[model samples]
Target: MRQFPLEMHHMAPGRVVEWRLRSTAGAQSPGPDGADGTADRRASFNQDKHFTVAEESRAADDPTASWIAVTFEVAGPLDEDALTGSLLAFVRRHEVLRCEFRRLAGELACAPIPAAELALDTVPVADFDRTEELTRFLVERFKRSIDTLSWPLFTMGAVLREDSATVYLAFDHIVCDGMSMPIVVQEVERGYEALRRGELPDPAPAPSYLDFAEEQRSRYLSIDEHDERLGYWKEFMASGDGEFFPRFPLELGVEPGRMYSIVNEASPLLDAAEAEVFEKACLAVDGKPFMGVLAAVAVCLREAGGPGVYRGFMPVSERGRAGWGNSVGWFVNTMPIEFDASPGRDFEQVMASVRAGFGEMIGHLDVPFVRAWELLAPREFAARSWPYPVNFFSYIDMRKCPGAERHEDWRPTSHVWSAQANGACSWFQRDAEGLHMNSIYSDTPAARRTMDGFLEALRETVREIARHGSFRRPIALTPPRRPALTPLDVAAFARRG
Candidate 1:
């Protein structure tokens, strides 16, 4: 028998209940081929999906949790029974929610839990004064470590107050991504309305995540087609210098049992008018908005690090396949983006180069990053070091997605997990207010100042493009020498705090 650790914190002024999920289906014995008997009883994820499952399984105790959470504020009438029913219905509609990872023949495999054995815990709160405490409780609940070996790696609960109730939904990253949150919200809302009206919600026509995973596995297993792409990746990694990015000067020496704290700095990159001009400029160069922004980031890195090649990780969505766009699952694949911003190149030329590189990467998206790493790096070297990208970039435009609008006057907000382990990550969001960029970095003092300067440099680069319609002239670059911070600077910063 295998057991997984479970932790729950209940802060509301009510009784707390815990439910243990069990499979109602009978267990199967091993077959003649020596394969695990359950292999035939469970649905399987593709190679890429299994990669994430394996990763989470290894880091089961990691305090840096992998979860996606969304909060919804519902005002006016509150129907507790209807909401509970809706949530259960939502769970039954998605196959991924009923699945768990199990060890089969020395490998991790996913199998569905019987619906009759599924469990949901309820906590009734009566005090409005406990709002803050309840919020923290739910946040911790959402951020709590997940046991991937257990079925249904998701939780749904509500903190009911007199005037309003806040619905909190958390899903393990192994089963969902950022794009899946809105879909889940929509379904929950639809289910709630239908249940309130004494009717069952109509099922969506979207394909199951399991089907998508099976297709992905088949495509990735096609050795003849992927071998050529693997060759390209091996060559790409071989051509680059094997050195990691330079560290910030303020980074202290590694201390025993010390975890790196991540800090985020946000800045308004462009106003609505400036964003319009930036979009027009990108169109003039036959580039996309993200490409234009990436060009600016490359310039920032080149200026700071003294040019060579700036490589970063960019996540590519695999939902482009027909009928898979609406499926809720982990369908993102991270790929490396290398930019050569050598001195003496005009901004237009840089944009063209970036566009070309992006086109080439799109052509070879079938090759997974882990497979390429295994083929490219030596075994001994791989054991000693992690080949994570020095920088990461992600962009999201909520306006472009359907069913993302406010529902029934309820406000919805998404809280994404930070990619601090990657050292530096920049997320750009396009909203009604304007264009905003948030840079998350290691918490060293030097990293903070550098990120501040980096944001300023990014703004200046964009402004230059907007003003001149191109980067015909070279922009000023920061010197490679690290700046010395005096004691007075630290004292003053602390005083300001």
Candidate 2:
């Protein structure tokens, strides 16, 4: 590992530039609590202990060759004083936020701390035209640091003026899963508020990211505890061809670009009458609405001309310990739901299988997903057996969104970024407010269109299952509105299209 010059340069009152020494040895360090010392941290997480970062001299042809950045547009008016301090405090309160790097045995690794050497860069707010640029920078940064903490894999850009401002978080999947994002944002809000009030905010006490890594290792070692779950996966994965599922044709092949998406409204079945039925259905008779969603999605794949072997990936939270309610770490386990997608099979049959499957897996939910894959799936090709790939479904408690609802102190925006993994994924979350579903498909135009069509078909399929309790052919619909385009429209359209 190379030593980083121990130099600190001032950028502003709240930020500074500091150097990190990369670790030469790619060895995983013991967690702050020693939870993962015995376990194979790298093997279990499918990630290494350390990652690398380099800054190249900027050139005319390579504008983005050196670093990743995100700049936001202020909403109503700019409040530089409050916003800037909040951002500085935000970095200080979170250990991952103040990261330093160095080499250990030839490996570049970042060390965690409760306080970071803040290097804040305040650019002219006028530089950004849209929020996309910041997100794009984050995407590039994540892609470059794919192997390490690649935890706190999230970044943000904010533009706060008196009238309005925007805040964004660009995330990396390894360090933080989608499930844990809300927790991080919530803390940021709390810290930002405390800074604004000139009070020290109380942060949640839980295992740090490094601690979680330690816990993962120890947890995996409890083979006796995980035997049942491991056994189940052994049997479950034994049936598949041991290949990582392909990226949903939608998300492939693109220089990471930014895309804006909103969750789709819930299906009509979520209404009172159907709500009871849905609850009872999810209760145990068959897979509940959660499992039912997966089953229905499996059916959608059959209708979409996808393979018959139905496999849905489900991510369950691993923050089961007390005081970990809102800890920011990647603690997700993906469960595989495999079934036959035969045309004649009734929805009830599928639901029953999925329900039973959920019950069986729930018993083994404690198993580390990485370890589960290692034991049950072949090491060389374990990636293919991810709970579900290309075609899968997820359910979320959407009723209570995970943040302060009042707009007094902060405003929140949602966005989807690249995980750099190879597959398309979709998640459905619902709460008292309503139902919302978002699918991440390959970036390829063809795959995107396929996902769009598949969603429409899945909606129809679920409607039939909920109301009719059986399958029925859906009528194809005509295309939606299209705009007339000229050559000029093509250029401007391409720019703003």
Specify the highest-TM-score model's number: 1
Cα-based lDDT at residue 404, candidate 1 = 51
Q: For residues 409-478, write the lDDT of model 1, one tens digit per residue.
A: 4444455453234356677865443466755566766666667667767787887777776765555554
TM-score of each prediction? 0.76, 0.65
TM-score of 2: 0.65
* C-alpha lDDT score of every prediction, in listed order: 0.58, 0.46
Q: Ten-residue segment with the worst summed lDDT in candidate 2?
A: 1-10
Residue 427 Cα positional deviation in candidate 2, in Å, after optimal superposition: 2.6
